[model samples]
Target: ACKKILISQRYRLQAMSLIHESLSYSTTYEKVDMSQYIKGIANNIQKYTHHTIVLDLEPCVLGMSDAMNLGLFLNEAISNASEHAYAKEVKGRIEVSLKYREEQCVLRIKDFGRGFDTNRSSHSLGLVLMEDISNFFNEGNMMIDFEEGTEIVFSFTQKKNT
Candidate 1:
């Protein structure tokens, strides 16, 4: 129980850090390209996991606030996959894809590693953060599919004025 609490606290700290970084990047909200930001996060995660990260990002733009929240969501999901998804002997693969359609942005992060039960309560903190962030956008929501591995999909509106 203590370990779970500690882990939850750590995730909270990471979410706060992501929010701070995004706020520091821009004052007034505007549509900004998110390719570089996603790449940067992937790069950072790859270094620690020594795993392959594949990115398929379309030319999508997002408001500063939305970007920050999404960044936080991705960070938690990716980190969870890297840390827990793979067996010690297996080299993991994490694929991230982003596409925009009809004023909505769809982001998918899939990991080729062992999957977990989304209904479990042990990993609620990260899941809660992702869900909360997704709520910020119009018609925003998240879904997790566990087949061979874990696939997390987040869909949200790209309305800049919001």
Candidate 2:
């Protein structure tokens, strides 16, 4: 329970940090450069977890609310991978990518660790939150696969302003 609490707190801090960093970078404070924002989050995760984070983000901008929600989603997904994907003291690498083209966005997070049973009936709060965040996107969809480690993909339409 203590470990879980700590992890939860860490995830919250990460989300807050993303928001703070976004505000710090924008004069209008209404838009966020998602590529840079995600890189920041990746740095934080790598620093504390000692896991290598490989990013392939294309430059994308989003409204503050969309950026925050997506940042939280990434935080939860990566936190879960850090905690459950690999054994303790086992250094692992996680891959993250964001591609936006023609008003379509695709985000992928993949980890090479012991995979989980996707058919399980358990629905943790983190998973629920991620799903909710994905839904906030236009025509958003989230897909999870655990064939060889776990891979999560979120596809949605980028907002008009972005």
RMSD of each: 3.5, 1.8
After superposition of all CA atoms, the RMSD between model 1 and the true structure is 3.5
Q: Write the per-residue lDDT of candidate 2 for residues 76-146, one digit (tens) a residue.
A: 88888887788887999899999987888888999999977555624877788888889898898999988
Most TM-score-accurate candidate: 2
Each model's backbone clash number: 0, 0
Q: Please give, for residues 1-162, the per-residue lDDT of candidate 1 as tens digits.
A: 797456545654654464446446755445545776777677666766767889999876676677777778888888878777898788889999998787878999999787986668346777877888888877898988889899999998765333
Each model's TM-score, in the order given?
Answer: 0.79, 0.91
Question: Per the 3 Å backbone cut-off, how many clashing residue pairs does candidate 2 have?
Answer: 0
Ten contiguous residues minimizing lDDT sum, candidate 1: 14-23
At residue 104, candidate 1 shows an lDDT of: 79
